[model samples]
Target: MERRLIHVITPGDHYSPRTGSAVPTVVHGLSAHAPAGTEPTVLVARGTYPDRYTSADVVEYLPGTEPGRWDRRLDPLRGALGVRRASSRPWAAALHDQDEWPPSVVVLHNAPQAVPLVDTTRHAVVLYAHNELLRTYSPREAALTLGGVTAVVCVSDFLAERTRRRLPPALRDRVAVVRNGVDGTVFRPGRRDASAPLEVTFVGRTIAAKGPDVLLEAVALMDRDDVHVTIVGSSGFSATDPLTPYERRVRAAAEGLRDRVTIRPFLPREAVADQLATTDVVVVPSVWPEPFALTVLEGMAAGAAVVASRIGGIPEAVADGGTLVPPGDPRALADALQVLADSPDRLAAEQDRARRRAAERPWSVVSAELDALLAARLDGQVTA
Candidate 1:
C-alpha cells in the first residue's frame, strides 16, 4: 500500500527550530515519523521573523503585507480567506493541482481563526484542539464551527472532557484525546551542582492562563533567600495590547524580590534546555486548565523535581512522576518548594522517578500511535 501524504495547517509561525509551541513540536515529530515516499507539508502563517527551519519544506501564507512582514491582524475580517488564498500559492498549490495524487489526510493544528476555508479534499479532516475555542467564541458561532468539524483531536483527556461538556451533544462524539509527547533525547536530565542554590524555573508565555502570578506569589510565600526563580518568555502583545493582566501581576509580585526573581524575554530552545540543566525544580502553577503542559514534560525530561498544580492534563502528564500541589494555593506551592529545597534526598528520589517517566514518553512512541490512528481513520474503521 502506498503511504499517505499528510498536510498540516497551523496558525503558528511554523518551522522555527527555537519555537517550542505544541503545534510546531507535533509537526516536527510527524515529519520524523513519516514513511519514506510519504510527503508531509506544513502551512504556516507568515510572520516578521525570518524562516528558521531551512531543511523542512514549508508553505508560507502571507496573510497581509505589513511594512516589516506578515501579521494576522492585516486581514482580520477575512483571515480564513487569506489562508486559503495563500494555500493556493506555489508552495501548497501542487497538492491541489496534482490530479494523480491527493492528500490522504488534512490535519489542522488550532487554526480556528482560519478553519472556515480549510479544503477537505474528500480526505479525513482532523482538527487538533490545543485549547478551548468555545471559551473564546460566542455560543452560536462555537456551535456552528465546532459542530461542523469532522473530528476533534484533543491534547489531553481533561481537555476532551471539558470540550465535550461545553459542546452540543451532537458534537461530543467527534472528540478524541491524543496527549502530546516530549523529545527525551534533547530534554533529558543533566548532572546537578550541589554548590549552586536551588534553581526554580518557569518557561511559558507570560499570560494569566499560565498562572505566572500564582508562581510569583508562591515564591514570595516561601520567603527563602537561597531559592531563585527564573521567569522566561515575552508578555507585551506589541505596543497595542501592552502587558497582559497576568504579566502585570507577575511584574508586581516580583517587585520586592527583584534580587531573587529574574524576569527575561523568551530564550531559544537550546537556552531553555541549558536553564533546565541547572534547575533544581520546575514549577508549573497554571490557574487555568492547561490542555497539556509540554513544559512539565520538558522539565521532567531535564531531571528537575517537577512541582505543578494538580489540574487539567498536568496530573495526567506527571502521573506520580513529580510533586503535585493544589492550583492557586500559594501556601501549598510554597510548601512543596520548601520541602524539595530542604530535603535533597527526597528531591533526588523524585528526580529519578521523573526522569524515568519522561523517558517513557518518547516522540517515536507517540508518532507510531498517531500513524495508526490516522490509518484507522482513513480505512473507515473509525468514525469521526
Candidate 2:
C-alpha cells in the first residue's frame, strides 16, 4: 500500500512566534494532530529557528529558492500580486524539485495565488484561506489563479462565502469551510480568585484594525478602578519592532489609566496562554472584519469569558460562548464588560460556557476534517 504524504506549507517563517501571523500556528496544530493513516510535514521558507519540534518534521526551502537580502524590497509588491515572497517563479520552481517522493497533496496556508504555482496534475493542491485575500482578484484573475487548485478550504463559513463571491462560478463549488481550531490542553484554564479585581486581557497586534486602542477606550468609559486591563502586544509581532504612531497614541491613552492599565510587548504563545489562564475576560475588540481570530479560540479554551466586536467571522467563533459589542463602539463595549465586571457569578458561568464551547472544536477535530478532505481529493471526488 502506498503511504499518503501531505506537505503543509506556510507563507512565512513557521518556527518563530514573532512572525505574528496565525498561519504558522494553524499549520502547527493541524499537522501535530493529523490522522494516523496520513503523514504530514511542514514546508517553509528557510530560516534559522530556536531548537524545537512542536509541529511535524519541517523542511526548509531548496537552496536557490531561498530569498536573497535584496528580495525583501519586493515583498509588498509580490504579496499584493498574490505571489510568494521574493517572487512566485523561483519558489514555484523549487516546489517541483521534489520528484523522489512528491507530496500526495500540497496544502498552502493563507497563500491563495500560490495555488497555480503547484502542479495540480502531479499533486492535489489545497489553498487554506485564513483571510479575505481574493477580494482584489477579478473574476478572470481569480479563475486563472485558482484554476489548478483541487479545493479551497476556508477557516469560517463567513470567509467561505466571501471567497466564493470572488471566484468564478465554476470554481465556487470547490470552496469548503473547515473552521480554525485551538489546542484545548495547552490553553486550559487556571484557578481564579473572585475576591480580586476583574482581570481583562487584550492579546493581538496593537493596530487600529485589531482595536487594542478601542479596548483602552472602553476601559476608560467604564472608569472602574477595580477592573485591571492588560494589553499584551506591540505595534507588530516582534517585541523589538519600533512603535508606530498609532501604537504611541494607544500608549498615551493607556497612560491616562495609570495603574489601572498595564501595556506589554508581544509575547510567545506559552506566555499568552499563561496570561489568558488567569484572565477573567479576554477582549478581541477588532474594528475591521476579522476573517477568523485564533485569539478568540485560545481565550475560550483558556476558560476566559470573551467580549469581541460583532463583525466578520467573530460572531461565528463567539457563538453563545462570548459577548459581542458593536464594532468601534467604546460605549457598547464598556457596557458589555461592566455587566460581567459587576457580577462574579455571570463571569464564572461565561468562563464555563467558553471552555465547553472551545472543547467542541479542538485541533484534533480540525485534523480529522482535513483528513476527510484529503481523502476526498485523493479519491478524485473533489471537483474543479
- For each of the candidates, the C-alpha root-mean-square deviation to the true structure, in angstroms, is 5.3, 3.5
Per-candidate TM-score against the hidden true structure: 0.81, 0.90
lDDT of 2 by residue, 1-384 (tens): 132444545434545554546877787778788777566766665554644355677677643454666776666556557555554544464475546545467777767656767766667778888888775567867777788887899988999999999888999989988988898877998988888889999999998999988888899989888899999998767798888999899999999999999998989888898999999999999999998888998999999999999999999899888999999999999999999999988988998899888998899998889778766766753222
Candidate 1 per-residue lDDT over residues 1-384, each given as its tens digit: 344544454443546767756677767766766655556666656672464554346765554332222443332323333323232233333234333435455676764443444455545567778877545444344555555456777888998887787677777787787777787766867778877778899988888777777888888888888889998776632223467666776777888787789986777777788888778899998888887898988999998989998998899889879988888888899998898889889889888888888887777777666666666656653232
Assess candidate 2 and give its lDDT. Answer: 0.80
| Residue pairs in collision within model 1 | none
Report clashes for each candidate as comma-separated counts: 0, 0
* Ten contiguous residues with the weakest lDDT in model 2: 1-10
TM-score of candidate 1 on Cα atoms, chains taken together? 0.81
lDDT accuracy of residue 85 in candidate 2: 51
Error of 1 at 354 (Å): 0.9
